[model samples]
Target: MCVVPTVIGVMSGFFSLLPDLLPMILPSEVQITKASDLEAQRGGKDAPMIRQGAVIGKSDRMCATVLIAKPRCSSAVHHHGEQETIIYAASGKGMRHELSPGDFAFIPPWTEHQEINDTDENVVWILIRSGPEPVVVYLTGWGGDEAKADSID
Candidate 1:
């Protein structure tokens, strides 16, 4: 028998508790990635305003990353094939109504959208996906590239 800690807030139901509690309840392994250990990566856009870092991935059924949207920048329109994405706004600007510290967005799989930061400050958010690997299918090409999303390998 094994015991696992419950995730107090944020998500709810079984899925919320599964990721962190899996190793405890089963014969699986758990891995933790410190904030200082993440490698900086582009936030799927050609602009410098958006940046991202992978928190946990590869060995798990899900992937988590932190996205930083700089002032006056907008990400190219894109979508993840069949992976649902949940975004938790940690800080910074909002698209419509004023978003507080803990506001979140549930993006359905294959939805096309873009993160626009019209404010003068950076907006930081946590992005959690439904799969271990990211499947980015850009609906609109970035940086004037003529390649279509469907043509990508």
Candidate 2:
């Protein structure tokens, strides 16, 4: 006698974990943002005043940008409200609390800090911040007024 095989038993192995496998099996789109597409925005005087091209940009979860500090310049003391930041010295250097090229600093949320460039040449650094958005709150201190004066439009 011919017998009919059961569908449940045959398909159980393939569809039993449909929910768990759907996400992995789906296709995803990748975003590619070009450098020329980014808008040039000015960082606070004490911060690196960016010009020309942007290295990266703020995303829904993180922010990446390049800092271009002129000679004898330094970013004003500021803090990121809830975003932690990773700053890497990409080129040209001065002194960042004794930190130098190939070196990176981890800035915790709400930590006040500054980037100093006392050399005659410009200092370039890549600043990466983690959060839904990068929020900077400048701190007022001894040289706060001076920093404001140095700020560019």
The prediction achieving the highest TM-score against the true structure is: 1
Give me the runs in candidate 2 sitting further than 4 Å from their true place. Answer: 1-28, 37-48, 51-58, 142-153
The local distance difference test score of model 2 is 0.66
Summing lDDT over every window of 10 consecutive residues in candidate 2, give the lowest-scoring window: 50-59
The lDDT, on a scale of 0 to 1, for candidate 1 is 0.69
Please, what are the lDDT tens digits per residue for candidate 2 over residues 39-63? 4344345444553334234345676
Off by over 4 Å in 1: 1-26, 39-47, 95-99, 141-153
Q: Best candidate, lDDT-wise?
A: 1
Distance (Å) between predicted and true CA of 29, model 2? 3.3
Residue 20's lDDT within candidate 2 is 71
lDDT of 1 by residue, 1-153 (tens): 333434533346767779778767786555676665554355355554554546455645678887776778766667777999888889986644455569989889877767777888878878888888666666545433334755643
